[model samples]
Target chain A: MAYTVEGKGPSHIGIRMSNDAPPSHKEEARAQAEEALFGFWVFLMSDLIIFSMLFATYATMTHALAGGPGPKQLFDIHSAALETIALLLSSFTCGLATLYMRYDGSVKKTLLWFVVTLLLGAVFLSLELHDFIAMAAKGGVPSRSGWLSASWALIGTHGLHVTTGCIWLLIMFAQVAKFGLDPLVQTRFMRLALFWHFLDVVWIGIFSIVYLLGVIS
Target chain B: MSADPRRERRQELHGYIAGLCLALILSAIPFAAVMTGALPRAGIVWTIAIAALCQVMVHFRLFLHIDLSRSHRDDLQLILFSLLIVVLMVGGTLWVLGNQRAMMG
Candidate 1:
């Protein structure tokens, strides 16, 4: 009778030549990283569902003006465009931070990029709040009309996510300061990067369907 | 680390730079079109839709690091599945509401 060991077959070549060899520590760590990141991706997908629903509700309420200000009167396309630019720049910076973390492995470079990203995020939030304030001055509050209500709900939700991402960015910045770039910190950064990027994607929808179409149509 | 991490870093930087430039251009197109009123409303709608979609892909590929490669297969699958669910739920909601509105008139 012949029995086959897990790593003893001819098929087990190169790195798996030894039958009793356990997976390397680095390999185990890589697997763990993959699992953690993949788990975060799943969470992001769930968040996507929520945003999609908000968008759907907004679509239905687009013309439900109810004798109130509409998108054209409420939305300043120039300001919205600036907000979009801010968020997009922050997303790019966030990508740079992650890239520095992975390849450069330099804390200074990574933190620098993170700080830039945070500042841009703050700019975006400020601009968004300004837009809301101006809209409110023009009778665009949520209670005024179904369209305003839906718009506030949809945009506000995205704003809330961006706020959360900014907070997470601060927390991660402190973590990097305290723990340096350990695997745990790196994993957390990866998740934060994912969140930031996801927010940017949601903003694309907002700027397109909400701002662009709102103004044009 | 790879045999040469500097090269890898340079390549990664290039990806981000390219993504950023492409995204800026994509964003500018629709905004410019809308602002200039160079296109009909329907044409502007198409432009915005296309540009927004391309930018989203750029974000996924370069920023979020999700692509069609085998390494990203699982993440891509999750995204595609989530997209399917979003379309179903949102589409269904719109369809029902639109139908109701039409019937009421």
Candidate 2:
């Protein structure tokens, strides 16, 4: 009537002993485990909705370069190429992290994949910020040209999303450090993985529709 | 079961490759057309259309994860709904803003 796991060395590994405890305690834990994921999805949807408005604003002004250096002139496809490949690959890596979390149950493998996702994300953001700074050094401020303005609006907006996602990753990593891949943490990470990939998908849209097409002539 | 998810993903990466190729082909064709002066400036529509398709691939394969399955009905429905809203907003922006610009000129 009591229960225990095969090994109880780490608190991260646990088994219910509901034989003595009331059923409500078990039910409460189960509900908490599930709600984090749904709540995370809702937050992600809200984030995307904000991104949608930014998209509209940037799209409206993309064509309005004010005769200054325009998308075809200033936006470098090669740099964007590096950023794109890094991000797209990171997305795959992040998905891998979730798989490891869900199935592998090795905190080490999940950590390994997460580090990859983090590094690639870092590289992508650094490259992009470098692009922005390079533009700024050349006096390509947002006020100079509507196209450049929209470029900042669009790409910079995405840059913000990437930044926050990175922060979220760090938080999740911290939680894992605290709890390993416990069920509660696993569910939390599952949500992060979904949002992280969602960011990647949005970047693909920005790359092709906004960067690749709008920038490259 | 030590089925590495990366293995399956490796194959799926090909689909991303194909999507990129299609996007480039679509964009490059118009580029070649313009370079050769085969199409008028108004033929920019081709570029927009191809860009739209490229995004479609990203959504289906990467984000929403829709495939030929019964359970994916929810995903398909979500995508269709988003598509409708996207089309309305983007199409309306293009039309109204474009017309406003034309009128100003």
Candidate 3:
């Protein structure tokens, strides 16, 4: 039988066909995972466009402080650095979870790493919220100026994504407990892993462009 | 799939750790440069931008496993295309608005 260039077969789930028995079982799971991953990648790219627009807006309005507080007055680089580290470490842990799932096929190890990732994500979110609250308390709220408005919109959107990701992580825990590491559950986990890493990448952009450059300027 | 599963696992572990280390260092250097005033303002901005771009590539290759390699070309192409759109939109907005600001001034 000839294989498609994309390696996806005729089934809606795109199950791969093979001659070998045991490996074919793995291939069956991989096929479903690949389809899910492709769909999720398209979603991520759209999400990327949204973030890029937000960043562009923030950049344009950076100078529109309206005589209000600026980044030098509001941004605490120490806290931002801490949050960055937390998110980056969480991404690493999420990658490790997927690796464990792929190699050892141990649901326990995968869940453990995922739990660690969730905690790190929570820490990052709390730090971000604390920053927002502190800024608001100082009259640096979104209504203060265009600069503040754009900054809040950009950073807040990212925070909302992290919040959704945390909720998804909880749902994953429940799914694993209920369904184990079946093909469907594994595909969900893989998509969540992509999402978690994608968030980290966005954060890097925010930190460098919004925080670091803001402080310097 | 690998002929030696143990070796493959080891290699995977190393990749994650190396990515983590590089990401940390890349993140820290920009912050340190900014905080310490180790460079001029323009230089610091450039450093942060470059570091962020590099770290993004590292995450793509190591964490997301998206690369230029044959196995991942489709996803890589998708990402590159998205990046092109982003650059056009963002860079265009900034350039136009910046010029408007200058004209207004």
Highest lDDT among the candidates is held by which one? 3
Candidate 3 chain A lowest-lDDT run of ten: A11-20
Q: Which stretches of candidate 3 lie over 4 Å from their true place?
A: A1-21
Query: Top model by TM-score, which number?
Result: 3
Q: Which rank order by lDDT, best down to worst?
A: 3, 1, 2
lDDT tens digits, residues B1-105, model 2?
114545655655555455455544544454454346565545654654565566556545644356656544544555566666666776787778878878994
State TM-scores per candidate: 0.91, 0.73, 0.92
Per-residue CA lDDT of model 1 for A1-217, tens digit only, reads: 2222243432221110112224564445555567778999999999999999999999988879998888889899999899989999998899888887776567898899999999999999999999999999998899999889999999999999999999999988877777677656777788898899899999999999999999887
iRMSD in angstroms, per model: 0.9, 4.9, 1.0
lDDT of 2 by residue, A1-217 (tens): 1112233222222112112224554454444444444455556555666666667767777668777776665666668767866876777677667655654577898899989999999999999989888888777789998767777887887888789889988998888887667665666666677777777767766766675556434
Q: Candidate 2: lDDT of A213?
A: 55
Between candidates 1 and 3, the one scoring higher on DockQ is: 3
**Model 1 spans with C-alpha error above 4 angstroms:** A1-23, B1-4
**Clashing pairs in model 1?**
none
- Cα deviation of A53, candidate 1, in Å: 0.3
Which candidate has the highest DockQ of all? 3
Candidate 1 structure quality by residue, lDDT tens digits, B1-105? 355657877877898899889999999999999999998888999999999999999988888878777767999999999999999999999999989877983
